[model samples]
Target: MPIYIAIFCVLPLLAGLIPEYLVCRFTRRKWWKVLPPLAVAAITALVTAGRLSVWESDVSPVTQLLFVPGVPAAFALLGTLLGWRLWKRLWGPRVVKDRRGG
Candidate 1:
């Protein structure tokens, strides 16, 4: 599989944890609130770097410009942002209410 595709497939599993971990380490906020953006940024950077590496040997400047790094980076950034937003919308405000009367 292409590196970008492989990265995309694997990112949800790996990148999903990034924001939570970062929040836990840096601040005390819960995972749901902070994870998505961090995950997306990490995935974008990784994808961009991978694309650059894959296209570094191309001879044509136009091919290099079109296929090298920018497009994948942009896609990864947008994908990550969308993924984060979806995750937030689905599970962002999950406060557990106490059932017993005080």
Candidate 2:
């Protein structure tokens, strides 16, 4: 019971994280950050809709299925923003060293 719930929650996150991280690593960049994650969530929701009932998605008022996948996008957005923030903080400026010393 709990295991299924865990899988349901984690599946979207993993699906979002892995690809976004890979893109980040290679490009060292983000595409409006949240957009990519949102895309991931949308696709995941669409693909898994068959496995999940409308009730599972829309009922319970808390475990809404439609929005579940977007949870991953929030994390992904946070990661992307944080990554860019850190990168800018660490490397956004140029360091100058005097070429000529007396």
Candidate 3:
């Protein structure tokens, strides 16, 4: 169960975080911010749906609908948010010191 959570949730979160951070940091385009979570959501949904169709699953439908894909997708969005923050910290305008001591 824990392993499943790690594979499904944490992996996607990292997958979303690293690339999004790098791209946004370099490109600094607001539009590029949308890609990671969207990709993660689509991939996670498809993988979860595939798992359900192929196996004798024990998880409930509500759990399937809500948690299986939802948690990972949410993590992905979170990664995007964190990535944006990191990019801002790295590349955003710096406050220059006043040498005249005004």
lDDT of each: 0.54, 0.55, 0.76
Better of 1 and 2 by lDDT: 2
TM-score of each: 0.37, 0.41, 0.68
lDDT of 3 by residue, 43-76 (tens): 8778687757534556566676667667877887
Residue pairs with colliding backbones in model 3 are none
Q: After superposition, how far is residue 13 of candidate 1 from its true place, in Å?
A: 12
Per-residue lDDT tens digits of candidate 2, residues 62-90? 44644554454455455545554655565
Candidate rank order under lDDT: 3, 2, 1
Model 1 residue 72 lDDT score: 51
Judged by lDDT against the true structure, how good is candidate 3? 0.76
- Superior by TM-score: candidate 1 or candidate 2: 2
lDDT of residue 5 for candidate 1? 65
So what's the TM-score on candidate 2? 0.41
On the 0 to 100 scale, the lDDT of residue 57 in model 3 is 59
| Best of the candidates, TM-score | 3
